[model samples]
Target: MKSRKAFGKLLQKYLEGKCSESERQLVEQWYELIDEAPRQDYTEKEWEALEYKLWRKIESESFETADESIESSKLGFWRTYRTGIAASVALLIGAGVWWYLGNQDTNPATIATQPTQSEIAIQDNTSSKPIKIDLEDGSTVTLSPHSQLQYPNHFAANKREVQLRGEALFEVSKDPEKPFYVITNEVVTKVLGTSFYVRSVDATKKIEVEVITGKVSVYEKEKVNNENPGVVLTPNHKVTFFTVEKHFITGLVEKPLPQIKSISKKPETFEFDDAPIGEVLNKLERVYGIDIELENDKLSTCPLTADITQQPLYTKLDIICATINGKYEVKGTTILISGKGCE
Candidate 1:
């Protein structure tokens, strides 16, 4: 604890510009010592990871500090990392110019080739956003607006892997021997060629995966078994996994929002003892062609047994607004909901 306190104080000085030159030298030396400390005190593995994290931070800051260089913005922040102490500070430059093709974003049409796992060259990212992809394996996917799809120039015989940040629908190319997998935020989506959607942009929750076809399994990486980290999701299932909260839940089936809304079909009534807030809002947006908002997260998960009417959009909105004792406002192209935690 004493060493930790001392270390913490030293870091504070370094950040605050309060460390004397001599003290600074001592602090740097101490940092090196701390970096290689034993696992009981400070694991070497963790130290290596910490070094990487610090370097990444440095690279990001360095790039961000170059706001004066407008064109350099196109130059991605890919400063080569010091792989080992003896390794030179290797620097590789990716090409410049960000190209937006309709809905796909291709960065650097003629960038210098590097040894990458896979490269996704975005096309254009304007309209017809969110390109949907269905692999040969019956897996379905909806690529988020302004996103790119990159796979191993070709997949290996044993794995179907992809990385995502924006959003996507994935109906995997099913191969039981080579399970389809996705790597995101220290968690993995493993499937035997099933269909699912992943939204990996929630800063708090950050990632939401919904199963639209077959069963998919999700769990944290390198965690203890006692943690009981995740659950298998089925069709019409959704889960919002929060790293901070350390929990993922199976949500209630949601009706289509106007985003997925179709006409003529009356709203099919349903009851949710513990439905997710996302599906409820989406369904209202789709079915009745109106927006349903929850003012409080506390009410977002509150169970409701309302008999929703699939009447006309306005009629359904009126019934919902009255049922929840709330108000709705329309702005430009989006609708907003206010008040009511649900009864």
Candidate 2:
């Protein structure tokens, strides 16, 4: 028999990973007993007798000097309605058991159960084209063929969360107070209002998130916290999380588009005639919202004359590099250009 305060201290120690081997085993045994109690059937008389024995055990335990009298009074209340309290405890055990073990350090080999009972699951098994789903929060999801999505009928007050399997394109409605979250097996993507694509069907357990508009934050599901905020992606950028290695790699998307829809009302003109290289690159940066760096300051003085309005971003870069005898390479999410300065 242990006092309530002693049991609370032991549970706190277990949560903090500071319990000794024996103490850890004791807490786990308690968890197992509570987990299995809901399945057992006992008559009302048996239940009352059992609760009487348990209460007597608890009341017999001696408390510390400060809590001795207060704990005695509390035990007296439990003693009065011990039978009814026992039934209530049995009803709540299954629902509340997760609170004890959910925060424990998880082993990589362990598989977590999907907790989406309250959500509506939709699997695109027969659809030839992507299925569009409109959420209650005004967000939209384009579920790809053979993909699956689980979402609540109504979003929670503080946040909007949905689960995804396979692939989908999300167009989240703008709600700064209520951020949106897309949860998968490996990674979690968060945004206020943005359009992004998430793919998690890779055979190698790779999770990919590509941003088409606004901004997104991507992080591992198990390692989520304020200190480790994970990677932040903007328009035209993408991040890949390798599940096996637990690593993140960021880069530009294959075909970067102008950030016109979100940033600018009118499309930018990409036709330049004898414009300074710096000015041309600056214009490109503004239109695309991607950083471009020049290795040499003298390259800014070089003149460029080209009409790259019809070309893709990479093609535009190719033409620019060829004209100035330079080469460009992508590092993370930025494009770096290096070449000899004009005479």
Candidate 3:
């Protein structure tokens, strides 16, 4: 039998392909020793080469003197080389472990997808612990303090859908047609290209859907005995889905304001007759109070509508009053809306 030191040298030689057939067989069992992975999947040939290279390096160390054992070697060059090799080994091991886990046979459903392919995270995260998700799609998702969202490996592949938990929002992409749909535990919101929110996790709760553009469809959950559910919604409007006590809730989403659409409707519908001009200002106060600054007459009869959320409040209000053939005069704690029947 060869001494342990000799055995190591011989194995190294085999890995370098410098060993005879008999010697090669002796280390054949170690052919799969370990591999280095730079990606989700590596070829067998490459794995073999990596293993061989590693073995050759490890076997090259001399056992004659602890001095030559790299670690104890007093020589700076040898010590550095040893440290570098040890670090490389650690890195390779980590990479191998990652690849192996990603290809775990136990998770056949998750295995089909390569790590390179990004995965969408869809979960309802509301009034509970924050969900931690590692996606295949190279995207990382951190749900809000109380919200839920559902995503699939592929959006709209068959049923572009997602499920919401509580009051979570989405930073969705601008897909052309294959719209993204989010279903709350009790509600569903659909979007082709936009950001929005959903809040309908608990049965005794209400869900809200607010769009930042594009379009959205909010539907109430339906309850049927083994049959798929149904939905009714109000397009181009932010809505609140309320709960019903009859086993489940079923109703169309309704909005307090008129509808608005980019492609379908270049115009918005809503008229503020002699309705409290103060109420109109209050609407702005409610919609963008935090973002807008209102003082003096700007607070009285300050009418607004039709995409005024993005522009400056003054510009927005100016347009609003102009649209209604009215004007305003700014005062200390109030704004006077005049020029029309806005008395």
Per-residue accuracy of model 3 over 1-343 as CA lDDT, tens digit each: 2232344455446546798888665455333233332332334345446646765655553233564534653655654555455445434433343233222232323112222212433343444565554333333345765554445565434334454455554655655555555655455465655655555546556666765444665554433222443332322235566665323232222222223433555533234555444565655545432122333454454444455544554565676677556775543223445544332
Better of 1 and 2 by TM-score: 2
Best to worst by TM-score, what's the order? Answer: 2, 1, 3
Q: Which candidate is the best by TM-score?
A: 2
RMSD after CA superposition, every candidate: 17.2, 12.9, 17.1
Predicted structure 2, TM vs. truth? 0.65
TM-score of each: 0.41, 0.65, 0.34
Query: Between 1 and 3, whose TM-score is larger?
Result: 1
By lDDT, the candidates rank as: 2, 1, 3
- Candidate of highest lDDT: 2
lDDT of 2 by residue, 1-343 (tens): 1233345456667777899999887666544433323223333344345445544543443232445546767765644444343333333332222222322333233223333333433344347789899998888899998777767776767888777878999999999999998887768899999999999875868999999999999998776654677899999999999888999999999899998733456666688888998999998898898999999878887888889888999999998888778899999999999986665
